[model samples]
Target: MDKMRVSGDRFVNERGEQVIFNGINLVEKDPANDMITPGGDRLYEQLATHGFNLIRFGIYWNKVEPAPGQIDMAYLGRVAAQIQLAARHELYVFLDMHQDLYAAKWGDGAPDWAVQDDGLAFNRSGLWSDSYFISPGLHHAQDHFWANDPASDGVGLTDHYLHAWQAIAKYFLEADNVIGFDLMNEPFPGSQAQEIVQAVLGYAGQRFQVTPDQLMAMWLDDTAKQKLLAQLNEGDTYSAVLQAMTPAVQAFETQTLNPFYEKMAAGLHDLLNGKALFLESSVFANIGVPSALTFTADNSLVYAPHAYDLVVDTNHFESYSTARLDHSLKVIRATQEKAGVPVVLGEWGAYFNQPETKAISEFHIQHVEANQWSQTYWSYYPEFFSSPTAAVLDRPYPQAINGDLRRYRYDPATQQFELAFKTLPGTSRIFVPHLATVELSQLAAQGMRADKRALPGGTGGVLFITADREQEVVLHLQIG
Candidate 1:
């Protein structure tokens, strides 16, 4: 099959079937080393067995171009092997040029030569993301990249980055499963990040009854801010602070981040002519901020945003809150609707496997279904597949729709599934994992005929429904 293409508000395959990309992020992203784990081919098969149809594969720029203007074909060849494996297992691949804190020296991204920090001391906080606000080195490195500053070879940094992506595109141009390129992961705001943080802190203080001067003092004094951050890290909700900062951060995204995306889009225009370009807003956009990205790539763009509750990464799993989730979804959906593009939840679910986390995961999945949006979960580590949470992570979903999907729901407790869509002439397929028993006798749909068959290798079942005309069709699968 030809790779999926963006068609207005959905991804459509060559058959013109709307594809709901369902999968996880697969990356061995450690600061000290970057390598695809051995036996990764088997992992791809494992994902397929669990009914996942996509993998947001992480490809580090540092690994792809270890030196300035160097294109490491050998390293790319290794990554290509993984793509081929995914293709063989019938999975789509979204190549995510992943980064955190700008460089491997700090986290994982641009190589050492690209990190031109103007003599600022490198510092880190207890939380990994705190560096975005506090570390001068990260700010400098990000500033240089955004400015498209010259590297050691006098070639502009972004030019080198684009060339690296071009090479990747050329390498994978023939791979049918290589569906798209996630331009960058959580593109952070540099230089003015501190200002943005301060704006947020000041807003928080005003709402929380703390004085602006005191907030400034706490922001300046690392120990004081860290103490407050520790409270947040311990699951103290800061809804007022996060809500207040939304406009400031959204402004930064509009003023700064969108232009960067435009530059990248211009650079990759020719190379990614037929492929989708997955764009993300600032990491702050994950909470609840309207994205400021408005690009001209009307047909090939996807608003690939991440979402996590405020209590994310805390030791305790906060109970699922519909109001909180609804607010974030409303904000995110408004951004997608404004850009006039399909929304693919690029990443979510980074919590541990506690009872509350399980409920939160279910809530997130429910929203994804309710919104009729595609998503790839946060990750796929070996332990994650074996953990009890996997039961919730892996479930039955409509893989390919013959037409526009109206809504879908799956009750894990009862193993029941329901889907509604406007009918077209093609076959709509739903993945039915082992835990769910969907007999043809239990299937119900109007103006459609349903058939049940085992998936490849007999790992699971697939409910295939064929519709005859252009009308609304509803499918119901009761657990046997």
Candidate 2:
């Protein structure tokens, strides 16, 4: 409604403290266009009430410019309206210009024009999975996203997309609560991991003539196998054993992902003028993970990674449990620590089979504590309501994103949200286990029975808190 505050890099307070910046994903819009409808307003309020502070949201290029050079005003209005609503609810925003395999025509639901079509036949190898699309030539091509492909829509296309982002940023960059802008969502340079790497590396000052991308013009190359081999010492047995991944890994870091960010960081600093968040990512869900990026500067650079254990990173092994996921978060935190950049998780969620969402919540909460970081959860779906967001966005609807508050967001197996609240300052119990769905009423009942105190917010007094095995269940009691 009114004006919002702008950001100038640093986000931590004078206290030098880091608190939980719980957020949700906000996606699920028209595949044919790039905008949020009035219908998103109600969800905005619902999200705020449920306690989400930061939101990682997206607007595919297809939606922004359905046809070349043609900007959509209605779509801009829709996006502007969404920002207003988020502002109303005090939700910090990260405007994401998203895409997948070039465009919706490639099957990701983005607008039609973003896809380059350019006679590059449908790889059809892997739709959303990793093993399908990646080829040696693609990996090689990914190694060089800038120079070799000046007009290459894959890399150059972002320049055009930035225009749309600038338009959106112009409207909300001044907003107090609006945080940053995500350049793209799950950027898949298609099977050209090597090519993507080559392009990026060349920009970073390395020169390569063969151009790995030209090698995988067909797409499905299965290069991760060789990429893994490169990780072994030159004379290592694995080189003889299964050297499928050595060069692939080499190109991924030196050429593709690194150079992509270098230009991106530069572009944002130049075009956006350090206005919004320059959040960086290693790869989409299925690509390899670099230890760190080349451009690890300050708060303006939100170093992020979409961490998924069984689903994306590795094959869907039997290790689809909470413990493995926790370990995965730790690894990501370690990478963030090494980079010396503010971190934000762009995407992380459980498979549909995980009956309860306790694991995912615990993973997030533990990560915040471990890194003392702030993050924008994977999705904030306003459409499919259920299909897009992670598993934790159900019942009691987690609407409040407070670092000082104790409330767990419950995303029902059926896509509803239930948020329950409890406190620990005034009650007898001090170690209230921080969890979701643990009974606040039981503690309230106990506090009432114990005559703990006469508090204003609730009848009972504050209590202590501790962790429960299941993340959502915190154990607590009343204050004296």
Q: Which candidate ranks first by lDDT, i.e. highest?
A: 1
Query: Candidate 1, 229: how far from true, in Å?
Result: 8.8
Q: In model 1, which regions exceed 4 Å deviation?
A: 31-33, 211-240, 319-323, 444-447, 456-459
lDDT of each: 0.77, 0.46
Lowest lDDT sum, 10 consecutive residues, model 2, at 425-434
TM-score of every model? 0.91, 0.62
| Candidate 2 residue lDDT tens string, 173-261 | 45656666777665544454544444433432222232445433322333543332233223333222212433454454556556766
The TM-score of candidate 2 is 0.62
RMSD, one per candidate, in order: 3.3, 10.0
Worst 10 residues of 1 by lDDT: 230-239
- Compared with the true structure, model 1 gives a TM-score of 0.91
lDDT of 1 at 149: 93
Cα deviation at 366, candidate 2, in Å, is: 2.5
